[model samples]
Target: MTSSAANRRTSLSAFLLGALLLLLLGGAAAVWALNRFPQVAQLAGLQPPADALVPATQPRAVATVPIGPQPLTNAVPVDALPATEARVATLEARLARVENATSRAESSAGRADALLVAFAARRAIDRGVALGYLEPLLTERFGPTHPQAVATIVTSSRRPVRLDQLAADFAVLAPTLKAAPESDSLWQTMRRQMGDLVTIRRADQPSQRPIATYDRAVARLNSGQVDQALAEAMRLPGITAAPAWVGNARRYIAAHRALDQIESAALLAR
Candidate 1:
């Protein structure tokens, strides 16, 4: 029985030593874990100094609904495209007006240049030159109204008026015209022949007698009153010079009338 007790005591001591060794190895492992992981140390109630611990992150601020109007999702604003389009349209209208004005100004300048050329051509025609090189320019500017009018003017301008020569010829013709008349009485013919020689002298007074009337017609022709002269001469019957003078006077009147028409047209066009 004493031997059994001694073995039992030795067994108890061996068991105690084995338990102490295990407890010491567990404590050393826990210390190593605490050094490697601070979170583990904090969980175990071993907090580190404030400087040694990582800082905690703050909560992010969240955006709330806008106070007033919210912005649209479109990349361009809803009203912006229309406003830009209106501006473009306005600019385009302005550009069109400018272009139209420029075109009108250029047309006016071109017409004015053509008119100058036409006037020069008219002067040359008056000097008895042919229509020649300037005919196209005059036709473009003026002949559209009356094509024949241009031809009439050019043809008439080339003809000589010759009213002075016609007047001198009419002086030679007046005696034959006054000598006898089919429409006059014998007393009237005798009165006309005597009045041709007799001098009635009142400087301010005018005479309507046939001899005095023929004298007035000759005076009108000398002064270039061709239409008036021809009219006065036609009143006296049996004047041989009437037909030729009438033809020339009609031609002169037509040329001047055509010139006036072209000038008026040019002014109105401007």
Candidate 2:
């Protein structure tokens, strides 16, 4: 061949070989980028490999316990609780009974003490009445005040005089035995009359033996025989029927007896 035709054929062949090498290198780079980043590959409209995709894990199920009645641990038994309550009730009732009995006993003691105090007060009043009224009346009429007149009356009478004689002697002393004034206390008048009634009853005995006994006692008493007077006075109540004034007379006698007892006790104490 000629020289120009040979140069043109060599250049054309070199250009076609370089174009093939560039296309191969570009294909290898694209494959390496898709392996490193799956998101880039997906955005480029490419599907990811099976190894790059991860599966979601499933949740496990939990076991449940069945609910039932709980066992009694620290609670008291239902049967025993009622019995304990009944025992407590019985103890309370017994305590209440005891308290009531104690209250009644205290009330009884209070009433007894009150009665004794009232009795003592009555005795003191009776004693005062006897001393202040009866004794003075006796002394004024029968003994010291008119001793001569009493002596004349007793001497005129025979020993163991009859009831008629005794009535006469009382009649002679009628002026002294007059009723007390309306202004005076009834207690004073009653006490004064008690002495007179005793004197009359003592003299008006049915039997001569008692009459003699009374006359002798009066005679001794007028002569200051205190013990003999008390002895004689004590005997008169048994012989006579109880008059309306008997209670007053008995109270006077009891007062004197009590005084005698008190004096005796005092002397013994000394």
Which candidate achieves the best lDDT against the true structure? 1
Candidate models: Cα lDDT each: 0.72, 0.49
- Name the 10 consecutive residues with the lowest summed lDDT in model 2: 155-164
Model 2 agreement with the true structure over 113-181: per-residue lDDT tens digits: 434433442344433322223233323433443344333333322122222332344334333223344
TM-score of 2: 0.26
Residue-wise C-alpha lDDT for candidate 1, range 1-270, written one tens digit per residue: 999999999999999999999999999999999989878988778986656677788899999877998767767876799999999999999999999999899879866875686577657644555666666777777777767767776676456444455667677778765445676798987776786677576988666466767888888877867677777777665565356655766675576567667766665564
* Global CA lDDT computed for model 1: 0.72
Candidate 1 off by > 4 Å: 1-76, 158-188, 191-229, 236-239
TM-score of each: 0.50, 0.26
Cα error, residue 71 of model 2, in Å, equals 12
lDDT of model 2, residue 25? 88
